[model samples]
Target chain A: MRALRLYLVQRVTAAIMAPLVFLHLGLILYAVQGGLSAGEILSRTQGSFFWAFIYGLFVLCASFHVSIGLTNILQEWTSLKRIAAANIAHTFGMGVMILGFRAVYAVVF
Target chain B: MTTTHKVSIWRGGAEGDYAHYDVPARESQTVLDVVTYVQRHLDPTLTYRFACRVGMCGSCAMTVNGVPRWTCRTHVSKVTGGGELKIGPLANMPVIKDLACDMTEFFEKWQKAQSRFIPTKTRKNPMEPIKPDTPARVAANAGIECINCGVCYAACDTVRWNADYLGPAALNRAWTLANDERDGGWADRLKAVSDHGGCHSCRSHQSCEAHCPNQLNPAASIAGLKRLSTSAYLKGELK
Candidate 1:
């Protein structure tokens, strides 16, 4: 994608991630403050479709935002051609998203 | 009151170094005066460009002590607090000779940004009158006094990092024309600015605003372009 599409999508993904970030932080604080163990947290998340969807969407947005940002940085800071940079960034994003979704699944299921 | 001013000027092309000269400082001596003196008396081989030594013409812009500025308007007393001056060609441009950097790429990018004022009316048609107080016109008027000095171009980190990025002056010019109500052709111009090397590359460093001799805020102009481009994209008008 050209910078036009990439720039717009990066911004959109950032907006989507804002609330997700707050929710994740709030969950962490609540869990720690309440002295909840990993098993206890997993008990609440297990078989919960709502938690799965929210975390799944977070992983997707995070991957897309990271990929777009890295593409811009590679273009500006390196001698890599635009196509090569985009290809590398997309590959990296896909790898990261796969790992992130695996973690989300482990915690939820 | 006749102390000597030590000036270091760049010599030759890209591989040049500073050549020092001890010029006699006078009251209200501009940096342009020191350069002219070196070329005239100290070393005739010295070369620099200047016009309208009163600062109207911006051809005399050079890196004075690591900052890009109009040498014609810069006073020796103000810059040389250490009694020494270091002058070189403007940054972010290939040096042609001594102090004059090649400006071809700069002008080419300026044109590429499509800053032209394309009118919808010809001489046969009546001129369309625009109100001065309109917000768009006021925004246009804010950035209309650019002198094409290339200082903003030199100071822009975006242009330095992204080779194809159209520097501040061109985008500023585009913003001014984008606001002009009488200029009918905006679709093409808007597309031109949305390219990979267009206004999106700016990191809002504000270096262009800091170094512009005319006190123009190219950062704000670029922000304006960003807003317009985003709006156009939302409306499905820009591709």
Candidate 2:
């Protein structure tokens, strides 16, 4: 893929993640301040598809965002290029998505 | 002003040490003057490069006090800290000798950016009339005066980190050509600069703009390239 396309992808994912990260942080604050117990948190999030969807999208965007940003960093710091760089970035993205989705599933179910 | 000043200069290629020399300081003296004094009086074997002894040629650039500058224009008083100076070749490049860096990569990047203007018409056709006041022409005019001094390239942290990155000089030249309305090479030029180590690699650190002797803003040019690439991609014009 062209670097322009990758640049766009990274920026788009960052844009998507920014608001989601803030909202998630706000939710954490709310939950802690409300003295919500583990049971209460579970009860609130277990069946809520809305929270699941938001977290899922967050995970997906963050995965792509981090991988792409790290790939750029690797290119700058090291001599990694072409297929090697792309493959490492893609592998990182896949790992993050898988781990994040599993965590989301554990929380939502 | 001191009658003599301590000057530490890099004395070897690739791997070397700073050799100290006492140079006679004079009124209205440039840094190049001090280097010349060392080579002429103290060390006959000291190697350096300069031409025209004026700012127009851009051949006398070197690191003065850890900052890349036109040595012919930089005065000893301005750069001397505590009665000492450290002069060396430009950073982010292979040092060919004392105070001279290899410009092969710098020129290579310019070629890779494909910065030459491609005329759309043959000589038989009428000359194209370009309005100087147009926004594109004005933007092009603003960045077109670069003499390839390599100061910006030396000052760039991106170039320090990424060897493949097309430094500010090449990208600035590319921006000028990209804005040329009569140039027929936009598609290929745009594609060339949109690749890895190209315009997208710029972090907008502004070091290039800050250190440029001509005061040209390469960060702005790279931004223009980014905007152009985005627009070209959206419009299906980029190949």
Candidate 3:
């Protein structure tokens, strides 16, 4: 049941990440090619709902995906059993979300 | 031409190491040929299993140099390194003796996965013709060629980790039954396969796909099962 939940979560996050990944890559290329400075980019991103929502969703999906994937690796490679691996994965997911939201807030709000 | 190859045969049970023997190699020599040479001439006690010299019987599978292959068809040139060969029992299984694994658990998982084909009609009922190109039949065709060689079972790391996890062949068999139009036990089979140690337990490492002797893709079949189970769950069809 835990494995199923993780698989579902990973699939859901992957679906979200698919488009977000392309959009993120496109934005990076567009920004770099347009010769936008770090400060200018930050200013444009600041107080923007669009940028905040997009980046926030991306971060959530990414965190969930990475956490699930890492949990599998830890369970397979290390001595961590199911419950311990799951707890560690949840903790890591929380860390990603908190840190990610903070960085998004720093830029957006 | 009396040609020879230096072969190392595993001599004991799970606790055994490789013992070296120089055997006369023949044209189109197979790994089974090397083992037979060692047992017949060099040592009389070397143990292995093979019925058909051809690949049809699915009985002569072993690990040749860390790769699971059918010993009858696997030529010496394909696996031997520096004229040295190491043959061992299939991994992820209890070695009953030299090169023969305890396939009880292996076949038992097949039963657990409900791999048997259940008929929906009797002799009085008219025959239902199945189209070869139908979507479900096509999907079944992609995975139905398994000869029960245990090659994929040996190659699967998920089975190694979780003993209850249904390995590739069993899951592949389940997928075929799930896609069969005439099979009445689809729901029951899916329920049996969707639990913690079933299709959901697969890590998608694809080692089974890599090592299948018939070159069948069990990974794709398992993915199909995952999709089927998820869809069944959404429709409240999964028991």
Backbone clash pairs for candidate 3 read none
DockQ of 2: 0.59
Pick the winner on DockQ between candidates 1 and 3. Answer: 1
Ranking by TM-score: 1, 2, 3
What TM-scores do the predictions have?
0.94, 0.92, 0.92
Enumerate clash totals for all models, in the order shown. Answer: 0, 0, 0
Query: Could you tell me how far off, in angstroms, the CA of residue B233 lies in candidate 1 after the best superposition?
Result: 2.0
User: On a 0 to 100 scale, what is the lDDT of residue A98 in model 2?
Assistant: 98
Writing each residue's lDDT as its tens digit, candidate 1 over A1-109 gives 1667777888899999999999989988888886878788899899988999999999999999999888888988899998888899999999989999998899888
Off by over 4 Å in 1: none
- What are the DockQ scores of the candidates, in order? 0.57, 0.59, 0.39
Provide the global lDDT of candidate 3 against the true structure.
0.87
Residue A107, candidate 1: Cα error in Å is 0.8
The alpha-carbon lDDT assigned to residue A104 of candidate 3 equals 97
Report how large a share of the reference interface contacts model 1 reproduces. Answer: 0.60
lDDT of 1 at B25: 79
